[model samples]
Target: MNRKNLTHKAGRDNAEPVGGGGRIRPVNNPREATKTRPAGGKDAKSTGIDRTRNFCIIAHIDHGKSTLADRLLDLTDAVPERERMEQILDSMDIERERGITIKAQAVRLVYRREENGDGGEAEYMLNLIDTPGHVDFSYEVSRAIAACEGALLVVDASQGIQAQTLANLYLAMEQDLEIIPVLNKIDLPVADVEAVTEELVELLGVDESEILKISAKTGQGVPEVLDAVVDRVPAPESAVEQTRGLVFDSHYDAYRGVISLVRLFDGELAKGDRVQAMGSEEEFEVLEVGCYSPKPTALPKLGVGEVGYIIAGLKDIEALRVGDTVTKVEDPAESVLPGYAKVLPTVYSGIYPTVGDDFERLRDALQKLQLNDASLFFEPENSRMGFGFRCGFLGLLHMEIIQERLEREFDLDLIASSPSVKYEVVLQGGETVEVTNPSDLPEVFEEIREPMVRATVICPKEYVGQVMGLCHEKRGVSVGMEYISTKRVQLTYDLPLGEIITDFFDALKSRTRGYASYDYDPKGYVASDLVKVEILVSGDPVDALSFIVHRDKAYYRGRAMVEKLKELIPRQQFEVPVQASIGKRIIARETVRAYRKDVIAKCYGGDITRKKKLLEQQKAGKKRMKQVGNVEIPQEAFLAAIRI
Candidate 1:
């Protein structure tokens, strides 16, 4: 089995058993794992620049990006019908089951025009990159936008324009790429095509005639979508003689080592050519160069304007970063590619091995997983969670996906602490410090500046009041609010990132009946009345459970946290005191009473003095236990206390 299958198997073995009496099969068919090569390298070489078009599909979650990609594959006939499966680009089992794409997948298609058609008889190459839809994976979408010259902006006819759709549209515009607006899912009975088209026209400032209507599920109007891409989307401009390529994505293969998915800009890269990474400055010989025809297909050479994969027999995956530029070792490009932005993690948390002895295994597993996930970051941290790694992610969803992958793919159980946003502290000496964890805050600081974001919520007019109220409760400042259509409204607010990371989305869904869509971008830091709230168990502070909150909400948050802790913690031999405190003063407290036993059950026929003596002895024993014994907190309690 390949490494991917092995990882899937490890996850299945460790998780709860499926409904049936058998293990779930891996997504890829083991029998079809052989290496494939495109039709001919010489033919691909003869293909001209005008015949190539590179673009990506961008939309909100559950808006049919993957389904549209599947239809495009079918139109291009890249993969045979017998071999094709649902969500072919989503190769991971978890993604398939969840109906979401976690990683960006690329596929190259060959489109041949008929002589009798409107266009001349010729063959064209189309490269399509599928991106994740959730806001947490916006960074991935941005990277996808950077690689292509155009994008297919897909929107659900039923749902209309959403928060992520607008975010992606703006990102594509920033990249200066031509966008082809598409209204998908016209086959659904509830799809209001006219309403959606109007919304798109109003929001995008595009002519009504420019939009294409299609149903990715039934393959309706898919050919028209492809024709629009060819006629409207501009081809890549030719580059200089020196070889230049951008590594947009990568994955580790047990059989072939690290394989990089790249878009060639300037020159051609043959199978045996030596190349160096501009960022890491590491040189290696290209063992194999290939393109994805729904599967990895080896090629003799990847010419300019082509999207393909490169295998350099690289043992260290760090050398091949997502945004790094790859060039010929001997004759490098004059300058590296522009728009290479380093991914900075915004959310921080503590991840610990469920079993202490699995530390080495967990570390090695994380290192392996980090090979493909450049956005992931970690460093050793010692806290109440014991010796574990402090991990940083782009957002909460990113954090959850990494944690789940670690548990499933690595065959290890893990515990993750509460997620936090980075805080800037201005010290008394006028020195600035950035703190990822509340325990790392300095004792004396003049001001604490918390990261804020410009959050946008797109919803029906009925939910405007609720959304505005929710924003106000989170200490948000209204930026702007306007009507996109007769019934749809767009509300913008500036809110602290800390508030959004903690159940804001869930609360929004609850109040808006799941009709509201939200997105946000960092707006730098602002001075705030922030205090480090710490949770104490029997008067001892738990560093892992400490968090920063506003002074006005501290008392309420403290009370809620202590009450939750009291309920989650098990009864001990002595009364356990759970307190929420800020520095030396306790804001709220709760107590878990000790388990009492009948110490004088057999003293019914005995004297009253004898029963009293027995009870006294029991009381003394309980006091001793309370003085010396430590509270053994369960893992679930950590999750309960983390919400605050």
Candidate 2:
């Protein structure tokens, strides 16, 4: 295929009709195609695996992976011209509005090669997977990489390589996949193509000529990217004659049940075949098979080396887990494929619904979302805030996205507690327990081990000092530093995940004027002098507002928490004291003064005894109220306290 021959028109005016007329036709029910079809069809398995190429587009956030994917779809005619739009694979409104890829999307494209001297043109099947670029969603990238043979390493020409770009590149290398370096956004006025090309050459150890410079936004040099995939990336090796497929991803559908996105490695999977999950050992009959032309277009079967979905009438999302293998029940593989390692959550928070009745609804929403996002973990929990779920996430952004999705998709009101990292607490008796919630901490513990992370920050050389200073304020230990280029530097640091989960990234960007890019990996746990600071409203501790902080920071953090609570809590009939304390010792306190009524206003001309009597009576009533009355903490107070 050539770029010059491709049309950039927006509508169907440039589109050719298939077997039917130009009129659109409704798709039949997918489950109706259960009968096995005859062999030797146009399927890729029959055509030979050499004509197929599986690859994924990986890059940092907002680096044009989605834009490049749009151009590829246009060039290959995989999408109808009328249906074309920017970031077509990003279906979620949050994703489109945020200008970031949250979930990884997969699509199958067909490209025809130019005619050779033999007077024959070859057609190739290109299975392209578009992955998220955020550090939190890197799990999606890893799953996408596992199902591909090559990766399009997209780098911004103006900004050059970034923290996530290197992170994703390492992931692709770990998979031993072929890397096709691509410099995107080259048409921008500020693009330093020569400088970025030098960086790529030095980092990838490839000739400068090997790097392809393309403006994905303008469709320049994009066809060559597809060509590289066809020429350089190898096809899937031949597999033994056994049916096996990997469920890289899955989601729930209201009408069709669970749709498992799978990549076939061995033998074909046809509709009506009995399949069992190798991990769960649960069996189910395949209801349908299909590929995503960005949509679920039904096919007779999914052949080897193909990326597609399978409908098995699975109603329970857990029945078909991501990273689980599916094999035929009659003839299963000798052993399951090496599936992905379990991803542990790095940050934990309490997710509660404002309305108590919506607890069940929240659980249902989380379950369906978990099917789509395997990284989300949640369990039932109860506290003074009422019934809620303690949810675990990959990072703060991941937690925010899930909360937004639940509210938008499920139409439920939710309140998220302060984010915390998992900590290992050793009891005085030498028993260790993991605590994800501050309220879950035992009364007495010998030592607390908090999870740590190694963070990488890349920025211009001018901001190196500012970046290091910010990290130091967050209790970060400097690991090392290196100059990627004469003008740019990369700094590495070891910091507690607790610090990163808060406003650390925001602070870093503020310090570097939004010029620094950051990424981090878990580095296990280390013992630290940590104490749980509890917040009290009128002498009663509020479990939701309690948090763990280093002993050195407890006083300052407690002071901040109480001060913020003072401003947020509404004035009451009785004086409400907002106090932050460690154990039985109060560290900080703020008072919301009682709303006094001028009982003596009507007795302005009365004697001194009358005024004093009224004042004393009013004081006694307030004292009585203070003894029996409970302080009502508003929802906004909890929200504001967590941010503090």
Candidate 3:
């Protein structure tokens, strides 16, 4: 399987039909131009559920999941040669620009098994799901895995196993999915195939022979991997009881409305059928249904064990939530599918429009974005930055994606406040409340408890001391440590989620020279000596600029904050005193000198009395202006200073 012979550089040649499970017909056009199949062509499958295979690719960030998916598509001839593009599944501009999969994309591939001394060749339908490799999108990965019966555990041959690789594998194991170990990038110059093979065997407890080696870049050994998927991974089990489909992912289309990526568990979904969402109890007529032929190709119906999409003309994105079950309206299933746990937002921030009048537009954009993103949570908020939405996200990357989408897709100029973690505050009145916005925090509290995360960092043994020191400086407690391999050590710590949400990951990457991988799970809230550090601009306390910090780091944080604010806030008519305080006590202060001019310059060479009188008048004017003039902080200044 050489890359040179795969397809033309300009893609002018028409793709040849592949001989597989079913007849592979050439569409010779984009998905939009392809016509719908006949009445029973999709639903009338001669094969049973035992012949179908559904699985996803799981790996660490940049471990080549998308590339491997491209090779599989090529092997199965799922995508046409003329229109084949790099990262076909990662359709979003942001996803391609960042070189990361933000959403899980599903595509159906047909593989024809060569008959061993038999008259006819048998074909198998392989529904391969491509998932994101970043920890921020782990929830998306989980939902995709739920729709699969097995997974291809991909590991980088050069980097060996990483934190997220193991994390994703554990998730698949939790779902009881059959696992197939694969070593990718075998063609790279620095690839150590044998060493990575041993690591996979030790970490996954799989036999060494089970590991398949391939170079997703050159399409080497990809067919063997596909064959292994058909041989090793078991087929999906059928349920004859009733109609049930798991809504793993979805997106909006202006013409078609909401198109949900679903996996049919029991019966079938067809066009013109009435379907109901078990969670929201919303019902709509199925406008269309089909599998992704690299695009939405309309089908008559999707049968059991099949993975495809359903369009129900849903205008309200909130009507169909991810992880909800969709069943027939008249004869619905008695119980819902074992849906996944809802993903909660771990980081919080304020998203405001720079121009005050764009508030409603921002609100509308967020509402539309939230239609596809289930983990994003938001509500209306009033602050110094004007009326905006206080939104929550999975992590820093997730926050960044939402911000970028709002700006790019909606053409919005947004002000994103610094990311903060949820804090548990216990008031003197015996009320415990979880606060995401620092401005929403009450004045008096009996105790302030901050969320903690159990973080696991895997790195080379030589960097253990540096990693441990970094964690300790962040106020982390060493929970556990062990050697994953002779040169690799896994270190676990309990640290404040606030600390982890900051520069911890970047620092870890730097200290380990990009060899360290890290992951964390929330460990709930713990009592801490924490207090709100307020920032006062020109003798006025700005609630939006306040932040909660541990008492031990209070002075350092307050000083750093005041210094940053000094650099950000411009000089006013009067000397604006920037102060950081805990309650009424000011801990740090900085000043922005007033812009002054020579008001007495024109009175030169005049009488001494005249000059003195002019000076007196100028001083009086200055005093009066200082008493009445208000400090006007620029939008940029607010964006810079309030992030602290």
Top-lDDT structure, candidate number = 2
Every candidate's lDDT:
0.81, 0.84, 0.79
Ranking by TM-score: 2, 1, 3
Show the lowest summed lDDT stretch of 10 residues, model 3.
Answer: 18-27
Give one digit per residue, the lDDT tens place, for model 1 in 416-511: 877888999999999999999889998888999999987879898999999999999999999888777777888888999999987899899999
Between candidates 2 and 3, the one scoring higher on TM-score is 2
**Going through the candidates in order, what is the number of backbone clashes in each?**
0, 0, 1
Residue 507 CA displacement from its true place in model 3, Å: 0.8
Each model's TM-score, in the order given? 0.89, 0.90, 0.88
Best-fitting candidate, measured by TM-score? Answer: 2
Global lDDT of model 2: 0.84
Query: Cα RMSD to native, each candidate?
Result: 10.4, 9.7, 9.9
lDDT (10s digit) by residue, model 3, range 1-644: 11122221111122121111111111111111112332123333553566788999999999999999999988878887898888999999999999999988899888887768676778888999999988888877777877887899899999888878866876676566778888999999999888778777666656677789999999998899988888887776653457888887888877888889898877788999999999899999998899986777888888877899998888888899777889999899887776556567888889889899999999888877876786788999988778899998988888889999999999999877767889888999998999887777788889888988777788889999999999999999998787776777888888998887767888899998999998777767899988878888878877667778889888998898788878878777667788999888999999988777777778768688887887788778777877887776665664565344
Model 3 regions lying over 4 Å from their true place: 1-48, 117-120, 600-644
lDDT (10s digit) by residue, model 2, range 593-617:
9999999989868589999999999
